[model samples]
Target: MVAITNTTSLTFLKDELDATLSQAESALEVFSEDTSRSGELKVCAEAFHQVRGICQILELPAAALMAEEMELVAEAIGRSVTPERMVGTLGNAIVLLGRYLEYVQLKNAAMPELLVGGINELRRSAGKPLIAESHFFRVDVTRERQPPAAPASTPRTDVTRLCRRMRHMYQVGLLGVLRGESRTSLKLVSRALARIDRLCGDAPMGRLWWVARAAVEALLADEMRLTPARKQLLSQFDRQIKRLVYEGERALESDAPLLLVKESVYLVSLATQDQGLIGEVKRAFSVRPRFTDGALQEELSLMSGAGGSVIRTVATALKEELNDIKSTLDMAAQGAADTDYGDLADTLVRLAGTLVMIGQSREAAQIRGRADQVRQWRNGEVDPEGMDFHALVDDLLMVENAVATLERRFAPADDINREVRNTRISLYQLDEARMTVVGECRAGISLTKRSLTSFIDSQGDRMHLSNVPSVLVGVSGGLMFLELDRARAILEGCRQYIEQSMLTGSGAPVREQMETLADAITSIDYYLESMEEHKPIGDAVLEVAEESLAELGYPVMRAPQPA
Candidate 1:
């Protein structure tokens, strides 16, 4: 494809494209004003269709996609009278496309990626799935990986049967992941991947499994969100597993899908962790994240909106001016002596200039028109008590509402559904103490797991279980202090089980019992991690811990709800 810059023909084409976009904008405005104007909608469709063709000729795929989506939305509007939001989206797309053409002309380059957001918005308004940000991102996935430790297996192991079982395990986890059970499903997926990695050994095919495991770990670590694109990538991993089961070990001989590898590597790069396989993969593949999703969205918001401080200052000044205007209008309507029409017109004229300075040219024009009306009323061209006076007041009220809308547009977003609970305690000190206790509890859980591992290895050694109860008790006390009564109860049950059965039993607990014990401990670990992150602790995890204990013949006590 030819470069977007330094092209005489492209410059001519862009000028023509600009004319078409303006036509689209005009048609869209007509349809928006009167949704019954299907012919205007058809005109918009034709304009965007032409715009799409021009983009394709210029080799601007992203831009073409945007135009194509806009055209489709225009057609949809013609089929039925769409909502105002959809019409507004179409209008914005028309304006944005025009601006993008100007940007390309000025910069002498076409950076199509910047148009992805607008394209997605058009698609969204048409009830279509959004394109991922990485739709334009390309990367080399042929780099050889430093394979993780090979999957443990014997010479007699049936690779096909093992692959089938592992694939089943992966599917179960994928279902959970799809249902939004992120933490638990991620753990299951990681486990399956670890097994698959062992089967693949150090061959080229093993690369996808290990890299995918790292990516899933990153997801588990809250390194990135489980976007639809990422979820689809994980689903592709299952397809690879299916290949191994049907195609036999030969599937492992070939490289994994290039897109899958790139996406997994991309995910690993986004993780903040600099240790273990995730960090190692980053080093080996030389993958460094450009930005996480949240960070990228934040940067986009900053680019699109005026600076916070600038907007706040403008808002304050606008409010003051509007207050004076309102006061004058109110007093004049009541026939007060302080009514001064000339002063009011002058203030409105200045306010119009300020609105234009803030990039509100349409609002500025409206205010300027109102100022002209004020002047006419002052010259006795219209009665102050007539319909004309009432229209002027109504228009001023609309401008006041616009000012309020501007304030809302720049206001910090809040999740009103998750109301922060009020407390009488000093929240700062309480939060600090909670953090300290949560940290210690996390440390204690880690220590207990290690001790439990040693006890299992030592085959009924009492010493390995000695420090377990004490550490758990300490963690339980911290949980109580933090008002996590359920977590405290679960920890207490584990403590009692270790004390009453494991340490005092004649021999090592059976393998099944030890596994169940591990399950209980692991569930508690997951809960604490969620708590530390301030995420909502689901009841399912606690039930899992309770079931594990019950299986071990130690029925857990239901604790009273925390105050």
Candidate 2:
């Protein structure tokens, strides 16, 4: 019944998912104490409730059931039940729900034993006392399983041996569960905890030991269901065990604090119960192939077909861009209407792509950033009667020098445009402060127009109420720079459009209206810039400005006569 009818739905869902993860992470921190108990329960309950709705929309009832169990677990803990009794089970359930969502064949529904027994197991663990002190038998770890052992709050020996032993059982068991060896995995988890109980004695490790033991018992009672979530949880348990063992071994070698090892052992035994460790475990590491030599060879072979030296070929291409830049610079200095360097931004980006082909990814990234800076420089301000292009030109020259030096070329650029160099020094003296203000204002408005156009195109029909604030903010920011009051009146229409889009699942149904307002703003920008430059607005721009200004209920636009 919860249908994602539009693109905005997924965006909203991702936001909700982000919030749930955040709350769960917070609950993980203080879920242990009675003091933070109520607060933790509230966050967990809210997250679970949100997750339930998402799962329902995706038709994942099993995942939903898992979330519901956690909600109930938190409620149980709120009313005097122990946190150790419920933490592991709830953490395990979250892992399962995540796996269910990442599904190959998402099911309509299924009531599994794991879901049914989770709450019951928590109640049973919460009611059970610390094991009797006499159960701390010194049995060999290889021996078969035994019944419940006694517990005590007394640490008698070093936990090193126990940590090493736990390391093995937890890892092997974690692997076993992943490969569907459920009984063996549960048995190993149980064995590891038993060893912890024997070694930890009366220390805080016993409480964590019980938490671990309870987790194993819960799985055994529910038959250790082979869900992806269960496997992931066990994997996390395995990683923590490995960390615990490694830390123990180092501690033993360095004669470090034995308490450190005991603390680690306790945490390992508790696994996902701690939240932060579980988060680390959830971060899957991967190896993505990058620019290996073979890839570089392939690129070399392709570009080599252009016939000249590779460095020369690349340099030649770069020089061509410089030539075009010089002309744009001249036009900018002359205050030409067509002095936009949007093409220059595109050129630099394309040049960076060529660097990528040569396995110069680092350089490519740097070049791309430099390209972005070009737009950033032009963002709020533009240089009309363009100021000196020396800084931009020098940056390009440095790239050429680095490349030529790497290639061991001694000769300088044979084709470097000296015509650009001839008057470049004199050009920087132009007092274009007034020209800059007018040009920048026009360029800012123009860029904003393009931004709106791009937004409407990309959002398609999935726009929602949430998107309006971004647009309104952007509009206000740009127009405020120019003292335009029209931005406020137009905002009401934006609000109405957002409300309607939510109902109809159509983004900005009155897009033309928005576009017209943008055009009007741009026309005003162009008119002001032309006036400041001591030139007449062209008839083409004047007529469009006249119509747009009148449409937006602004003052009439009369074309300024030639000076």
Q: Which candidate is the best by lDDT?
A: 1
Pairs of residues clashing in candidate 2: 96-229, 131-151, 132-150, 132-151, 135-150, 152-202, 153-202, 154-202
Per-candidate Cα lDDT values, in order, are 0.73, 0.47
Candidate 1 residue lDDT tens string, 1-563: 11475467668887789888888888888877887777998898898889888888877787788888988888887665446878888888877777777766665756555677788888888888877655666567787776455544423136676577567657756766776656666775786787678767776788888789888988877546676678888888999999988887678678878778878887776677768888878887887555555554443454354345787788788878777887877777667765667788888899889888877888789879988878755543445689878776666665555555566466422111122234223333444577788789889999999998898888778898898998998998878777677778888889998998887876678765776677678767766665555443355556667777877788788855659
lDDT of 2: 0.47
In order of appearance, the predictions have TM-scores of 0.57, 0.21
- Which run of 10 residues does model 1 get worst, by summed lDDT? 412-421
Q: Cα-based RMSD of the predictions, in order?
A: 14.5, 32.2
lDDT by residue (322-397, candidate 2, tens digit) is: 6676677667666666545677778878878877775567666766777786765553256543433555665555
The residue-level lDDT of candidate 1 at 168 comes to 64
The C-alpha stretches of model 1 lying farther than 4 A from their native spots are 1-19, 81-85, 95-117, 129-133, 138-149, 152-212, 219-266, 269-275, 279-295, 306-436, 450-465, 496-519, 550-563
TM-score of 1: 0.57
Scanning candidate 2 in windows of ten residues, the lowest lDDT window is 132-141
